[model samples]
Target: MTVRVRFAPSPTGMFHVGGARSALQNWIYAKQQGGVFVLRIEDTDAARNKPEWTEGILSALDWIGISRGSYEGPYFQSANAGEHRAAATRLYESGRAYYCDCTREDVQARTGSQYQGYDGYHRDLGLGPGPGHALRFRTPDEGSTVVVDLIRGEPTFENKLIEDFVIARGDGSPVFLLANVVDDMTMGITHVIRAEEHLPNTPKQQLLWDALGVKPPVWAHVPVVVNEKRQKLSKRRDKVALEAYRDEGYLAGAMRNYLMLLGWAPSGDREIVEWSVIEDEFRLEEVNPSPAFFDEKKLRAFNGEYIRALPVSEFIDACQPWLTGTGTIAPPPWQPEEYDADAFAAVAPLAQTRLAVLSEIVPNVDFLFLASPLIDEAAWTKTMKDGSADLLDAAIAAFEALQSWDAESLKSTLEAVGAERGLKLGKTQAPVRVAVTGRTVGLPLFESLEVLGRERTLTRMRAARLRLV
Candidate 1:
């Protein structure tokens, strides 16, 4: 059989990180097996689903490099409502489902809130479809439904404990379970790889599939992503949106790789994995069932590594959005005319190494574009607390006397000043560094000074001398 899998996401809001991981796992497995990776938007909930949210889902997927060429459809589940409703009707006519007129208050009156679920009071009502009745599946009362999971071992749920959940409302609109199962059966999704939170839904879905006489897909419930406090990633409390991460300048490749490692490890002790290796080695069976914490620190570390590995040109290109103020990062502190490509290229290599994300590109090199560095008061106070006047005066004098202006020339000049004052280069350069660059630390000082030119460098040093007074 051709292995087929689908990422069925409900387009209710922002495309979440958990959803991204699930989509990635499905995409990987599909690619590895030479199978179909499907994108199914289950957007039937009119109250919550919006067209913009659906667009957001597709945008997020494409941004992460999971493009249309790699997979089939973007099938909208809302478009298949007629088929879903028909299946629900078939279930009703086939005696697999029946109409239940019990309201929540009625169910609670009989089965108390403390009870596991709705009492089967209306199970045998034999009521025909009416305005007050909702269609419910007829779950077996005496047996257990076992979910044959790939990641987790077989777990059986007692049918008695499994409430006969509603399949469709009186208005004939199919519920999520009904629509989901019908869609999965029609799409031939061979493996249902998703977060572990959906494990409970497995037994219910499996039962629905069995009742409908269609085979249930293989289940692989991977671990749920948690926050620092070990709580499930909440929309209200956690930064769960993939767009949010992308906006913050995370590399798509890094985000994809990190998402893969949440609850699954690559071959051996490797963390920085190549796409080819990930495609070859990814297996749903190897996924862990334990919860995975979404550690922003680790993700940022991975991003830094990925960013540093990028070719200098590619690194600079990736930073264009941040540097040119054309993308997610807000308008850069400096103007567009001040953004010199050549200057940035000279400093790109050094800045690339220091950044964990592309957003850091601006702050690290903003000094290069601004008229004068935006001085950090604390950094200035620390470096210029004492003897700053002498250091700036000496730096201005040595730099002004220099006929050559290059990293080597600047290095020698600064080193001579340090030596003459009996101070180390780090000590002697501290005040000068702060004056030229806003922050105390940044790209290589000599190289940066070289790019800033001899005149501008001397001017900043003299400005620092005046500030000392």
Candidate 2:
């Protein structure tokens, strides 16, 4: 049988980081098995579904290298409602399932405990289907169902412990559990590689697959992604959106590389490796079954490494979205006309080292393009203290007389000015840096001054000296 796997996501909100990880895992597994990767939108929740959310899911998948057309049908689950209902009917007719009118209150009244699950009150009742009737799978009371998983070992669930789950609602529409299984069966999925959160429902789904007279797919429930507190990463509390990271200037390669390391690592000592390396070495069996922590700080550090590893040209290209505020990125502080390409290219290497994300590119280079430095109030108050007025005067005079305006010449020139004041280069450049770049710290001071050029640098110094007066 050709190996088939599906990445089914509900188009409700942002494409979650956890969901992205699952998609990548499924994609890799399929590729490794020489199988097909399917993209299925579980847009069955009509109350929460939107067209844009579906498109966002597609775009996010594309961003992570799961490009459109590379995978099978983005076959929507809603489109297969008929199949879902038919499977529900077949299960009921075969004695594997039955209909009953049991509300939450009714079940609670029967069991006398709100904490307990359904009491199987509807199992043997020959109640005819009606407006209030719900279809539930009649779980066997004897043996346990063993789910063969790739990452996790065979997880056994007792039939007695498993509740008689509802397959279809009172309105006769199939619920997610039945619809999911039917859809998987319809698509010929050979593997079910999903997050560990779905493990509880696996036995039910597996039962559905069996009752429907179809063999269940191979299962591999990867570890649940958690936050620093070990709580499952939640949209309300955590920055879990993949698009948020993408828009923040994270390289796709870096994001995906870090994502893979959430539950599994490559062979040997390195966590950061090429995509080709990951594709070659990734194995579901090797994945750790513990909860994977989504460390944002580590991811940023990984992104920095990725940004620094980039070829200068590629780095420049990558920074464009944040640089120009194009696409989904917000516009930079400077106007479009003020952005100087040659000047940015000159300082791009210097800026590249300091940036952990692409968004930093704008602030690092903003001072170079603006007509006047966008001074930071606190930096100005802190740096332009007592000898600053005198220092700017001396530095401006020294800079004006310079024969060549380069980073080397500029550094030596400022060094001498600071020396004359019995101060170090750090002290001397503090006022100059803030007088130029809005921030106290940024790209190498001399390199930045060189890019800013002789005229603009002097004009800014004179402006600073006047501000001090």
The candidate that wins on TM-score is 2
TM-score of decoy 2:
0.98
Number of the predicted model whose lDDT against the real structure is largest: 2
Candidate 2's displacement at residue 192, Å, is 0.4
Per-prediction TM-score to the true structure, in the order listed: 0.96, 0.98
Model 1 — TM-score against the truth?
A: 0.96
Tell me the lDDT of model 2 at 367: 92
Q: How much lDDT does candidate 1 score?
A: 0.88
The superposed Cα distance between candidate 1 and the true structure at residue 328, in angstroms, equals 3.2
lDDT of 2 at 260: 98
Q: Tens digits of per-residue lDDT for model 1 on 73-142?
A: 9898988988898999899999989998887888777766855477777777789998868999889889
lDDT of each: 0.88, 0.93
